[model samples]
Target chain A: MQYPEPIARLIDSYMKLPGIGEKSATRLAFYTLGMSDADVDNFAKSLRAVKRDLHYCSVCGNITEDDPCPICKDKTRDQSRVLVVERSRDIMAMERMKEYHGLYHVLHGTISPSEGTGPQDINLESLLKRLEAHKEIQEVIVATNASLDGETTAQYLAHLIKPAGIKVTRLAHGLSAGADIDYTDEVTLFRAVQGRTEM
Target chain B: MQYPEPIARLIDSYMKLPGIGEKSATRLAFYTLGMSDADVDNFAKSLRAVKRDLHYCSVCGNITEDDPCPICKDKTRDQSRVLVVERSRDIMAMERMKEYHGLYHVLHGTISPSEGTGPQDINLESLLKRLEAHKEIQEVIVATNASLDGETTAQYLAHLIKPAGIKVTRLAHGLSAGADIDYTDEVTLFRAVQGRTEM
Candidate 1:
C-alpha cells in the first residue's frame, strides 16, 4: 500500500537497519505518526544527540562521550591485562559481568575472509600501538564469540602479541552450564570434547 | 549495569514503550548512538514533528495534520455508513482490508470501567454530534474488538441511538474464516449460535 511522501521516507530510513524489515519499518513509522509533536521531537533529538555527542575512545576504541572513556582513564582498573572484543556491545556485556577489571580494545568487527573483512579492515593497528606503548600489559584476552571468523581473528591476534612477550588467551569453550549434550550444536560438542577438563 | 547520564536518560525513554525492556532499551539506545549524525537528526526531528504537526481531526477524532482528516474531507467516499473503531491502529487495519468504503470514527480508546475509561473519556460526544447533524447517516457499525468493554460500549451506544431513529449494528461475531469450529472460544461460539442464519 502507498503511504504519504513523508511517511514513506521515514519507513525507508527505518528499513535500513540490520534486523528490521519492511513490515516492522511500517509499524514503527505509524507509531511515530501517532506520537505528539513534542514527544516525536524529543525522540528525534535523542537520536541526533547520540551521534553528535558520542565518539570512540582514542585508546580502546570503545564507545564513549569522552576521548579516553571512563574505563580506560580509571586509575583503579588493572592496567596489566586487556580484553579484546568484536564490538562495543560485547564491551557492554563484559562490563555487566562485573568480573573484568582490565581495560578493553574494541576491534569493531572480526576478520572474515568470506565477507572480505581482513586485519587491515578493522582497528587492529591501534591495538598494536597500545601494546607497544603500554609496558605494564602482561596479558591480552581474546573474548570474541566462538565462531569461525572469531577463532581466526583470535589466532591472528595471539600470533601478533606473542613477539611482544605478552601472553594471549582465547576465552574457553565447552558445554554450556545447563545445555543438553544432544541438543548442543556439533561445533560446540566438538570443542567440548577437544577442551575436556579434569573432573 | 550503570551507564553515563545521557545514555541512561535515552535508554529510560526507550524503555517507556509497551514491549521494550531494560536490555532492549539499552540495545536501541546504543544502536541510535552508532547511527550517523544526519540519520540521528532526522529521527529526532521526525519524533518532534509527529507530535507537533499532527492534531486530532475535529470531526472524526482520527489523527490528522488538517482539521477534518483526509477521509472526512473526501467527497467521493460514502458517509452514510460510518465504521466506529477503538483506536487509530484499528482504522489502519480496516484501511488495509480494502473492503470497507465507508467513513470512520476513532474513539482513541475503548470504554473500560476498570481502567477509569468511560464514554466521556474518548471521542464519543463528537461522534454523537456528527450523527445528530448529518440526516443522511443511515447506519453506524460498531466495529470495536470483541472484548467486554467493546461489547458494553456498543450496547450502551445502541440504547442511546434507538430513539434517534438511526440503525446501529455491531460487527459480525462468529468463527473467523479458515478457523476450525473446535478452536473457537465459548463466547464466540455462543454468539455464532445466537446469530445463526438460514441455509
Candidate 2:
C-alpha cells in the first residue's frame, strides 16, 4: 500500500539528498514523523537558515555568512601561502589537523572533461584574480585528490600560475599513517621508496 | 576552526538523528548547503508537515494522517483475523510481503519492565476494548519481534485474550533466509531443526 500524502512527499524530498536511497528516505521520513513538534520546527528552521544566511566567499569561493570569510579576513593567518582545495569541505579536513596556518582557496570542483566540467566552470577565475591582486602571495599548494581529474586540474593550475612567477606545489604521495607496509599498494610503496628521506 | 553559525546549527540538528554521527552530520549539513534554495525549502516544509499533519489512528493505534488508518478502514481486509504488532512500522513490513490480508492492531510498544513500559503504557486498553466491542474478531496473530520483551508481551496478551474465547498465536521462530550454516548461531539452528515441517 502507498504511504499517506504527507509521508510520501517527505520521503520524496529526502530522496533528493546525496547518497540517500528509497529505503533510507523512508526511514528518515518516519523518524521525522516521530519527532516532537518543537524539535521538528527547529530542524526546519535550520534547513532554511543554511540557505538564507550563508553565501560563497568572493575571495576564495568558500561558503560563509559574510562576503569575505573569517579565514580570509584573519590577519594572523599566513596569507602568503594559500592551500587550493577542490571543495569547501576540504578546508575542514585541513583545519582538523590543527597544523596548517595558511589561508585557503576553494576551487569548488576539478576540471573533469568526462563530467563536462572545464577550467571556466569552476572557481578558477577567482583564484587567478586573488593571486594577481595579492602580490605578497609566494606559494600555491595544489591539494587536490590523487585522481585523474584532480591531477589534470593541478597541472592546468600549475601551468597558469608558474608563468606568473609564483611557486606551485602538490601534496606529497607516500604511505598513510597507521597503514601496514605489507598491505600498502605498489604505487604508494614505490613513491615512498623514491622519496625516502636520509636521517 | 569551527564552521559558521548557520552551518554549525544545521550540523548540530543533523547529529540529533538516530545512527548519525558527527562525520555524517557534517556531510549532510554541507550537502544541504549545496542544494538549491527551492530544494531546501521543500525539505524544510516536509519536516514541518510530518509533525504537523500525521497523527495516531484512533482505531488501530497506527500513525496516519486520518482518524482511522487506511488499513483499519479498508473493507477488503479480513476483519476476523487481526495481526497484533508492537509498532506501526511492523505493519509496513508485513504489508510489503503482499500476502497478509488481515486487519492490524498496533501496540505502539511491548511490555518491558526494564524500560518501565507496561501494558497500560502502550495501546493495550484500546485492543481489549476493540475485541470486546467487535464480536467478529476470531484470531489474533502476535507479530512482535523475537526478543525477551516481545515474548513476555505475547504471553501476557495470550493470558488476557484466551479467557474471551479468542484464538491467540505467536509468530514461529527459525533461521532466517540466505543465512549461512557456519555463521548461524546455535539457538537458531536448534529452533530450525525443532520446527522442521513436511515439504
Candidate 3:
C-alpha cells in the first residue's frame, strides 16, 4: 500500500537530497512523524529560511543575509591580506581555524579545464575588480583545495594578479596536521621534506 | 565562522534526523541552498504537511491521512486473515512485496522485557478488542522481525488468541531467499532443516 499521500510526498522530497535513497527517505519520513509539533514546525521554518533569508555577499561572493556579508563589512579584519577560496563554506572553515583575521574572496568554483569551467565562468572578474578598487590590499592568498583544478586556478590567479604588483600566494600542501608519516603519500612526503624548516 | 544564521539553523534541523551528524547536516544544508526555488518550496511544504496532515489509523494503529487507513477501509482484501506487525513502516515493507492481500493490525512495538516495554505498553488492547469485535477474522499471521522481543511478542499473541478458536501462526524463520547457503548462520540453517517442506 502507498504511504499516505503526505508521507509519500515527504519521502520523495527527502530522496532529492544527496546520498539519500528511497529507503532512507522512508525512514526519515517516519522519524519525522515521531518528532514534536514545535520541532517539526521549526525544521520546516529553517528549511524555508535558508533559501529565503540567505544570499551571496555582493562584495566577496560569500553567503550571508547582508549584501556585503559580515566578513566583508568588518573593518577590524586585516584588509591588506585577502584569502581566496572556491566556496563560501570555505570562509566558515577558515573562521573556525581563528588564525586568519584577514578579508575573504569566494571564487564559487575552480577552473576545471576538463569540465569547461574557465576563469570567465567562475567568480574571477569580480576578484580583479575588487583588487583594483582596494589599493590597500597587499596580498591575495589562494587557499583553494590541493586538487588539480585548484592548482590550475591558483596558477591562473598568480599569473593575473602578479602583473598588478600585488603579492599572490597559495596555501602550502604537505602532511595534514593529524597525518602519520608511515601512511603519507609519496608526493606529500616529498613536498613535506622540501618545505621542511631547520627546526 | 558561523554558517550564517539561516544555514546554521538548517544544519541543526538536519542533524535531528537519524544517522545524520554535523558534517552530513552541513553538506545537506549547502545542497539545499543549491536546489531550485520551486523544489525548496515543495520540500518545505511537504515537511510541514507530514506533521500537520497525517495521523495514526484509529482501527489498526498504522499511520495514515485517513482515520481508519486505506488498508482497514478496503473491502476487497481478505477479511479472514489479519497480518500483525510491530510498526506502520513494517506494513509498508509487507505491502511492497505485493504478495499479501490481507488486512493488517499494527502493534506499534513488540514486548521487550529488557527494555521495559510490556505487552500492555504496546497497542495490544485495541488488537484484542478488534478480534473480539470482528468475528470474520479467522487467522492471524504474526510477522514481527526475527528478534528476541519479536519472538516473545509472537508467543504472547498466540497464547492470548488461540483460546478463542482462531488459527494463530508465526512467520517461518529460515535462510532468507537469495541467501548464500555456505555463509548462512547455524541457527537459520537449523530452522531451514526443521521446516523443510516436501517437494
TM-score for all models, in order of appearance = 0.87, 0.92, 0.96
Candidate 2 residue lDDT tens string, A92-124 = 889989999999999989999889999988899
Highest lDDT against the true fold, candidate: 3
Candidate 1: residue A9 Cα off by (Å): 4.7
**What are the lDDT scores of the predictions, listed in order?**
0.82, 0.91, 0.92
Cα displacement (Å) at residue B101, model 3: 1.3
Off by over 4 Å in 1: A1-18, A21-39, A175-199, B175-199
Ranking by lDDT: 3, 2, 1
Task: Give the per-residue lDDT digits (tens) of candidate 1, residues B1-199.
Answer: 4566567777776665445689877878878777777776666655555556667789887777778888889878897989899876677778889988888998877888889888889889988999999988899999988899898888888988867999998898887999888898898899999989999
Clashes of each: 10, 0, 1
Top candidate on DockQ is 3
Candidate 1 clashes between residue pairs 3 or more apart in a chain or in different chains: A36-B51, A37-B51, A37-B52, A40-B47, A40-B48, A41-B47, A41-B48, A44-B43, A44-B44, A45-B44
Q: Model 3 chain A: which ten-residue window has the lowest total lDDT?
A: A190-199
DockQ score, prediction 1: 0.35
The alpha-carbon lDDT assigned to residue A104 of candidate 1 equals: 93
Candidate 2: where is the Cα deviation over 4 Å? Answer: B113-116, B175-186
Better of 1 and 2 by lDDT: 2
Residue pairs in clash, model 2:
none
Candidate 3: what is its chain A TM-score?
0.94
